[model samples]
Target: MLVRLIVLALGIPAILALQDGSPWPVREFRGAWIATVANIDWPSSHSLTTDQQKHELTSMLDTLLDQNFNAVVLQVRTSGDALYNSSLEPWSYYLTGRQGQAPSPYYDPLEFAVQEAHKRNMEVHAWFNPYRARSGSSSKSGLAHNHMANRFPQYSYAYGNNLWMDPGAKVVQDFILSVFRDVVSRYDIDGVHMDDYFYPYPVSGVSFPDSHTYSAYVSSGGRLSLADWRRDSVNTLVHNIYTTVKSIKSHVKVGISPFGIWKPGHPHTIHGLSSYDSLYADSKKWLELGWVDYMTPQLYWKIDPPQQSYPVLLDWWLQQNKMNRHVYVGNYASAVVTKSWPVSELQRQVHLSRDRRDQLSLGNVFFSAKIFSHNDHRIGDLFKSAEYSAPALQPEMTWLTAPAPPVPQNIHASADYRIHWSGDSSGSVRSWAIYRLRADVWELTSVLNRDTLEFAAHPGYYAVRSVNRLGKESDAVTLHVGDITVGVVGKK
Candidate 1:
């Protein structure tokens, strides 16, 4: 009885807090990162058959959908390496266990991942770790052809064994642009994502080793500090990335996940660690220039902590995003210490952000995929709460138009084989999701590949929901085969 009462005490407010009383905003961006750096999130511990890699990834998408996250920032290219087939950079070391090696089974991971994510009505933003050349640079540990350390010796630098591409070099900028052009032109990614690693954070007593590049700039009469010049390099890329993406597919979303502290400018305290001067992430300017459709500042630090408060940074960002881009606060959900933060604290922040979305159109994106699976995860509890439990159509971008795919036609079912009105031969439909009825309830079964509409009769009953480019699922078109199967057996 004591345990039950204790539970009730904690439960009541959590239940009330779960209420979606906050009026849903007209436009919001909700997403999470699926990190591939050092095999952090997906393609776990590599060298698995290509089929296994695809299966593991599909499971990740399933988990994301269950948690009510509508978008996935999947790392497509990290460290000048490609997760999908690429001719420019080597294959990702994370994928095939060695850099420059293709997947053993000859399948395109990008093509497969995007299709699977779309099946669950989720967006796959192509996440890239720009400027980070290797995990931690040991020349022997780096990819052989990674021009940063090899072919273009002038534009590379070493700090603590890790090598980084020179963000200051014009050639590096063009190379990065080429990669983005390749991705946006080749794949069906809904968004292009760049994370917070622009110029590596300063290490104590160690310069970035860019004196040669700095000298060259000085010779050219450039007047800026090392930090400010580094920031301009990133700013130039940010401007180019936004323009290049829209030039290719005007509707494709362009976004960044920068470090949370823009400058540690709060008069109340001293922040020795700041992104602007140290890491050179000029994220606030990106928002003001409208260079990004959405920005996820890694507000990873705790709320009300001495040096920085979560709410303090969030408010500062809100004021900066007045240019109309979505400001999705990136919360550190997985590593949260329960002792410091009761479950409600994080949920309250989410509620607070949503409550004030009108001021900034802000939403929350948890840092990763696994944290929400934890029952104790604040965001997890928030999602399971009936208020957020229901399906939410992804906040729309009226900014982009996705015409509805043509309707499925000639729908039919049979004992021998089942069929339906499916396939968007117009070459526009993304995929079709199949659903089945159990009594009065309709549940999604499995998503057939793009342009596929029929299934084998042996696998229970059947139905289908065609999905469009915008991840909008259509009403289920039922194809009942139970009667036909029984009748055919009787005839036999």
Candidate 2:
């Protein structure tokens, strides 16, 4: 009889389940990649008007927000061109039809993306391709006069249908570093991301044509072999980028999405192209050295394949995290669209990652965002109904040191059942968490942006808390409500 009465008060079996210790306010990094090169994802085309471009981006963000994703890895720099305004590099040919053309009536895409994403309580990570100077399809005649290839022809060479800047040159490294510094200092981005394009992927039997740079290094008394020298150059840049970004903004995360397989036969069953030898990336060393805040290995394979099995590779990557940084598995959502892979395959992969969350397998990032926009095979619907049915906070990085924001103040409920609150004066709060009590247990109902101070409410017990930029939550301020009056229940 007591149990029945408790159930009646709770009003639902789901609320009762919370009393059994089901986790509330789940912490996970749900992210997606938004590629811009060749207009693969956003803008749909380079020739769209500024308003059309803005609408396309906001629409995509709305879709992700609806599905409860927490982060977006947006490719801001592709092939030495800028998606946003820049004096150093040309406007991306992929952003406007011409290589150096800005949007009609000119609005910075990165700035707009950051603002819109924050309004939706989602993170925007700026993605850069480090060494590729020009993609294969880009025409030399169409290259902007100020493009890196045209300005420093001596440092760039054509290889495998693309123009690549010499990674071994000191000038090239300094230039890339400048680009990183420029973006970090300018935008309020949550993270700085680099994909697996450190050195261009190998071409069949074609050398990288860096003999001139290599000869200079050898004359300067460098003793490492060709392969080791290449790897060392990449390592130096990776280390410098990590330290540089931290020096500028310690809270900003530095992440890398290296190719899935570190080395063929790493786990005794895996076999694939070796990013270490072929691409000169040394990604495993970067993680071991604690240079990255998170590592998103593009483990874009099926679960059952013995050679490049998703679970097998995922386990190996987790085991390699001696520094205990985050490892968010990168899924190939485009595969479901292009190759007709079953949606269940992606779901099973997500379940596998969740199964190992205690081991630092914290989340998943899809390869491209267009899959969600297209809703191919109903992937968006399935994820919304299953893995992303509830809202989640981005997993906290414990290494980051920031004091929690002050608790929300003046929390009141009005006659219309609307809740209102005031944020801290320090301006450190990034979001607010609203929690409601059911069956004597508190459950997080929503996380809203800092600027949003009110929400529709119901006649119930509620608590409001402040969340800081570092993902730290402040103590709660509670209110008990009725049809006519709201009573303060004090802090939690």
Candidate 3:
């Protein structure tokens, strides 16, 4: 009878459907930024107890997971201090109430976030502000004893209301690189992320107090003009970060979210702040040189605006992708809540990004994680119902090579209609992709963590595939369920 049932299942055309034409498992990089500076997103306040903080963080992660977000760019190093335990820098005052203080109950926040995010099958990118030492909005408390500003006073300067580390200083460069190395070597992060704060945004009348550093550079036989020199310094740092991260973990991605416009007039009609000249961030150069695995240009404008038009700028950024890397648009989710912009604007931007899905325009990362909680104008609800309705796997990085995970072993369906499988001993498996065939189409039902070996099954054709840390999917092992009485393994 079992053999006859197997033959009958094989005869069913829908049971033999392959994964090639499946429209369900979409591959896109959906992410959100959790800003820690000034406690903008997480902790809600510096006074939250350790358990409270954990609860808040877990709640945020749960929200993102429900929304089907695939990655999170967490601000681990907001300023010069550390959100997690670090010997190189003191605890972030934003995490605790005072500089150089630890949480009352000792716990590494980065480690905790990584473990929790991985359990939900989301990627965590450690976000760092490479050059800003202290923001104007930071507490007026004294700098920590080990802070770069205190230890290397000559390299740190107060420009406008913020203290900044001199990008031209070789010592400063080495210190930043050491911090990157420390985090990448110690943590299981999926990527290293930096934002548009390379050199400080200009203040009207006061020039950056880097004349002394410039004079030293000239004496050391550096002949480039000040602007070119500054750009070069920032470029060097960006290059070094990419190489260093790849050396430590080749699969770990390096990403940058520069200001929306690279430079005005590059596209003829576009007019805005030139991140190239002002911030000393040659972000276009970084993308062209293939220094970053993904570039999320902060194209945070509406589609209708002509100057900083979202679609226009998005197209320009894609055109600059000479290396054919991923370009995930940095959307302005905060605009809806703060500026009272209609939620439909953001929804349209998602549609525009999807329209260009074939042109290396991969995904979108909203400005903040807080807007979801605010749920202003039902933005979160609209997204979950429309563009983000289904789960998506993070796009594969072909440059970062890893062997495909082994197929799930002994995939069996029990009499109780529960499907079970065991993973190999290789330990490379990170998640499992479960698919169910409905209406002659295979849909990715869920991507569960490695520890999940059994799934509550329904009467249908189901398949399970192992997914590795690099987002590589193994071939599928199929099973057919009938009447909750018999299970048959379908040929792939």
Candidate 4:
């Protein structure tokens, strides 16, 4: 039953009220990675049909929506392949039973993902591992003969059980850029994301055989050392991708989640594999140079660990954020099931992030999304009940420009006390936020999707504002409530 209200002289708060001492910000990034490689997160298995795969994805998104998650980082290009249509690469073996084979009914997962995520008012970031040729086992022979790895053997190298595109080669960089540009130009994604697999995690007993490429660079009068040259190669790709994505769609974001520890002794006490030295990824320099829109270091450790303290590393990353880009902490939710980490471990991490509100440390992204559906250790419930109970707009990027939509019109009160307004058809408006006057202030009651044109009034002063795809809110239109007769309804 809707509660009756008389006009109050006091003003209500303009946002979703902080109900339970919540330290959450009005704008925060809450997302999860939906890994599709080797069926780590989606499809459960490669044997599922198209309808079944669709059902599993829908259910995952539904779970996130129910838990109030606002974004999804979906792995589309897992290992030098495409989950969507592509002329450059073959179909992902994890998506179908075999590589180079299309779904029986033929559907593009990236397109379907963007459409479904938008319907739920969730942003979908298309995640790709730019240089990985194959993971775990050699799929080189299985890959289509026309695949780049097959066509251009000189561009790739085999190390351990994996195949990788030599980062030192200019031709390889151009090929990778073209593949990603194809996706960015065709699909309507919110962001382009990549994981920490730069130069591939070091494999013992065998080194990445890039000597030929390095020798070529040296013969061409390159000045830098081998290590610096490798970092420069990745840095060039990072800068190129950032510029290319913005050139195509300025509002779309570019994010990278690199290895957590930058350098062991940089923090004095912390000791771990150096992302800078071993992986040749200069994540710190990237932030200092403003090459990325956001950075998520995989801070997959307990808060008070002796060496790899989560808080200590979090602060270190924050200080390195010279560009003031969004720095989301990469959390390991799958560890809860695999390592039996207490559910409270996740809660403490969330609290630590909120408590330390530095300029760069904004929000979090769970490792994989599947565990949420299982309710493993009640991790999902803890987040929903505590930190994420209130809704938040995706954190804004002031560097990108987007037109603020015009205020919605035709605000009127219906005879049944339901408020109605004219829907914006400009295709920019993503949803409408309904604000109600309470305690003399306006507070957000609901964020109605664009299709929802009317809202049942709660017998109070109301205002509606349009929110754009970039999470920018428009000025609101007001609708006043008056004396009306309405019947009471039973409680659920």
Candidate 5:
């Protein structure tokens, strides 16, 4: 039986009988955030041996791969530190027990993560907390001598037991840019991701002590309101970061996961912490100006809440996506923690994202990665049986351009029913997808990386499409085989 494809941005239609039973889209952003702060999702703890860290990360990637997740947003820079080698910042205490201490015998967690993730055909986006400096337990005396906050106290401030970089400081912006530049230049990361920690969530009476910077700005003839100035500072960094990443590698995406509520009264009766006023993120402006390649807002609420409805908030964010960039809805996995949330809510949220494909909100990314291994909540089983039974290609980013890869050159059946095809030499081809014609409809059977050039064929017409590093696909080349059929295949 033929099923409607869910991945197509085929546009809306007048009448439709399509149901959830339809074939899951071949392109979707099924991802999970692998948080490393405080060892919440990785390493198990900072004290583990280097071997243990590698084992833990490998296992996590393997599990997510089996579950059909295409991307992992790993916390490489948890709080003004590096999970990988860096001359600009000290090592993250989360990776080693002490900040500035490298892993025993030396190993780069970011490098390892990128390599392992690629092995599984999963894209890795280096997640960075741009403004956060120190966690609650960290103290200036205890921080590394070379730590940015310690080295340049003027650019940093302590608020409620944590250190934060003054967003308004030009030096802070330059330092952050250098740190990211080093990362993008040295690593093969798929994207650079930032979360919604701008200006820190408002404390009841505590204010972000940026008066000195604000004073300096006003003395230099700044007239914008403090809020607008703060927003502008963040906007500057966001836009510069996008341009910088593209300059280094035009295909690498830049994404931000801002707080769900953009601002109060933006859809009326939507009551929540205003990312605009409180956090000074002005994330809506980022979307409008086309600064980010994708926006994954943390929409953690249940589907129907009296104060902040999930769907309402989702639609609001979708409308604000004026630049047509990708928006992957971030969902909280109840399984991540033993919470009061119903297990079914995770599945429901996934369905919501898929059902509204035509309306924008292209895909979904779970808040965490570890919980799926628990199996206590049966979250893995639910996805395997429902949303993720089939494999998916990571969605394309039209903004980052790359020429379509050339089709496979030669194809023929070898011994033992195994099919062989020549690999393309075009630098753009990262992998190849094998599709078998079944019931006169093309069905994806497998996706092989550039390393593998053959697969065991199970009989039928076969076709291959080259996928580039940015996940863009080339035209297909097909070959029909029944009795030793051999020839250069053409597009179907």
Candidate 6:
């Protein structure tokens, strides 16, 4: 039986029932996030053992795999502190009891997490908070070597004791770029990602306290006013990061998850709290200018939210996406309550986005991993139940098209656990996805960076498919597990 395609934005009534159970449209993007700040998602409050931390992460990965998700947007540096070992920033205090103090049993969280995610055939995007220096409570603060607050006093600004890297300073932008470069070069993350927290979320009564930097900027003949200067500084970093990511690994994607409403619509209004206007985040400009590969606007409100209706904002975000960069809506699977929702709130929005007519409206990314752990809410499984039968690869940028993957062949497999295989090239295929059919379910098991399709079995039914340019996955070839028998002419 085909899984139900969500009926969210199908628009027409007659098409509703007809499209039901029609598998998700091809070329969709599906993913979830794992936040590390304040130990919100993983390591469960920073009170667990190192192994416990790993176990929690593994379970999160398993859940994503079960849901057939293809990517994870993981927070690697939540607040200028490194979740993994860093030569510059200190080990995240959230990982250990004290800042800069290594986990009793030291390990590289980013490397370990990315490697594990890769094994599961999922893309892990390293997410960072470039401007946040503190999340409150300096009890765990680190005064280690090269700390931004210490090394560059002028480039850092204090906002209520907690520090923020001054957006008016060009050097601050350079430092953020360095962080992205360090991670992208050192780890195998599929993407370098950031969130909506640029410019400190705009304190209603209090300003960013960047006046000192601003004064210097003005005196130095900077061409912009404070706001414009702040924006340009951030834009510089954004453009720089995008260029750096592509330069290092052409396949690596750079993306941002910005606040849903760009600007509010009013008499003299757009009627929304926009990152573009307030946070000085030119998200739309970035997308239009082609600085990044994709954008996931956090449409966190309910379908008909008080200020911004989900449908209106969704369509608005779509309009901004005319540049055709991948536009994945950030889903609120965690139900974190941006506002108040009635009983059927999240359930309603889920229906809206998943079934939009244009497959390009495609998939979504959940906010935090905890929602899917142990299938806690069962909503995660509910998502897969509506998945598209085939994974629709994100369209190729043509500008960044690498070599295509050759198709696999040999077609050798038996019910009795024996297999053999071979495949050809498309000149763009850089990887292959392996899967298995257990109890009538076609589940993705692992992704391998290889040219050959030949492989051994592990005792159950299996399949392997090549992935080519534009992230499109070829059809899977079935294989058996734990071969105790010999190969023969058979179906792939």
- Per-residue lDDT over 155-179 for candidate 3, one digit per residue giving the tens place of the 0 to 100 score: 8888887888999998999999999
TM-score of 5: 0.92
lDDT scores of the candidates, listed in order? 0.70, 0.86, 0.85, 0.83, 0.82, 0.68
List model 4 lDDT by residue over 25-86, tens digit each.
Answer: 66678999999988988978989999998998999998988887889999998878889999
Which of the two, 3 or 4, has more TM-score? 3
Over 1-492, each residue of candidate 1 has an lDDT whose tens digit, in order, gives: 000000111100101111334343323356778888778777877778888888888877777677666678888877778898887888888898888888987988898988888777678899887787776664635465754456567777666657787889988888889889999999988999888888887778998878788789989999998878888988999999999999999868888888877876642553646788888888889999899988887877766775777777777788887577777788776655434555566676677677766676457777676566444446566665632454444454445667655555566765465655545677766666554444434444444557466765433445555566564544445545544334344231
Better of 1 and 2 by TM-score: 2
The count of backbone overlaps in candidate 5 is 0
Model 3: weakest 10-residue lDDT segment is 1-10
Per-residue lDDT, model 2, residue 327, is 92
User: Which model is ahead, 1 or 5, in terms of TM-score?
Assistant: 5
Q: Once model 5 is optimally superposed onto the true structure by TM-score, how far is the C-alpha of residue 408 displaced, in angstroms?
A: 1.5
Output the better candidate (1/6) by lDDT. Answer: 1
Candidate 2 — worst ten consecutive residues by lDDT sum?
1-10
Judged by lDDT, which candidate is best?
A: 2
For each candidate, give its TM-score against the true structure: 0.78, 0.93, 0.93, 0.93, 0.92, 0.81
Say which prediction, candidate 3 or candidate 5, comes out ahead on TM-score: 3
Point out where model 1 deviates above 4 Å. Answer: 1-28, 140-142, 267-272, 337-342, 373-382, 398-492
- Candidate 5 stretches with Cα past 4 Å from truth are 1-23, 335-338, 481-492
Show the lowest summed lDDT stretch of 10 residues, model 4: 3-12
